[model samples]
Target: MKRIHAAPGTISPVGPYSQAVISGHLVFTAGQIPSLGSFDEQPESFKGQVRQTFANLAAILETAGSSLSHIVKVNAYLTDPAQLEPFNEVYREILGHAPPARTTVCVQLWGVSLEIDCVAELIAKENGQ
Candidate 1:
């Protein structure tokens, strides 16, 4: 069985998808964009966008009973190749030494410069079920 999750305070999905879904011990998150409030508004700086995207990803994972530290893989998309260094800097700061495996690629995006999605290990629920 699978469970869908939506994190409070995170931007709602712009399409017909849940923020994250869990099956077995794994939780997968939807691609999170740099929308601080509404999807119409995006951060101006590439660094800011990346930070917010990770923040959103963390929130979604937490909602699904996981966390940034539990992430095993990440898929990131960027509109500009120049942003890669800055994105990496922020990624290191957020994920620390044990960062997950990641792949980042330059791609055109609508209204935002970057998007990120991840998979993480789910924490056991109360009662150990």
Candidate 2:
């Protein structure tokens, strides 16, 4: 069986998808963008966008009974390659020691500067399983 997770404070999905789905010990999160309220209100700087994106991802993971420390893999998409350095700086601060394996690529995002999706281990079993 699988469990779906959504946080009321986090941005609602813009498409047909849950914020995250937990199956077994793994939590899979949908790609997160830097929209705390609405897509139109995204941060102007790449650094700001990256920070917001990570915050969104963290919220979804927390809702799924996981955390950034438990993340095993991440996939990041950036609209510009030049944003990589700033993104890395924020990523290191948020992830801290023993960061997850990550793959980042330059891609065209409509309005946001970047998007991130991740997979993490559940910190605890639901209802003790």
Candidate 3:
């Protein structure tokens, strides 16, 4: 088992929690927000915020020997119900055609538009070791 700190180019966790954890073939990620662990200067647009959040998520997953394509489940939190369709647009663009199973809900997010976390399988080597 391994605990992951923030990856390069990603925001560090501001509290007492790891960015992700690697256990056997799975990687469980912490909720990723748009900022670099700060509440100031959050993206003004919903899509922009979503993109930044995913970027942070991808960085941590990669550091855990996983990629976005390896994700098996996702839990997304949105602060606005009206942004669901717009969020889906960006989600499709980034996650591609076959996205993982997901559960998204509108919630009260402090100083941010959204938060995302996921569980992903580790990418295997070509040798399948």
Give lDDT per model, in order: 0.85, 0.85, 0.89
lDDT tens digits, residues 1-129, model 1? 465645887867778888887878999888999888888777787788888888888788877888999999999998888888898999999886798898989999887888899999988678886
lDDT of 2 by residue, 19-54 (tens): 898888899999989987877877888788888888
Candidate 2 Cα errors over 4 Å, as ranges: 3-5, 125-129
* Per-candidate TM-score against the hidden true structure: 0.90, 0.90, 0.93
Number of clashing pairs, model 1?
0
Global Cα RMSD, each model: 1.7, 2.0, 1.3
**Residue-by-residue lDDT tens digits, candidate 3, 1-129:** 999987887767779999999999999999999885565756788889898888888999988899998999999999989989999999999886788999999999877889999999999989995
C-alpha lDDT of residue 36 in model 1: 83
Pick by lDDT: which candidate is best? 3
Q: Candidate 1: minimum summed lDDT over ten consecutive residues — where?
A: 1-10
- Stretches off by above 4 angstroms in model 3 are none
Ranking by lDDT: 3, 2, 1
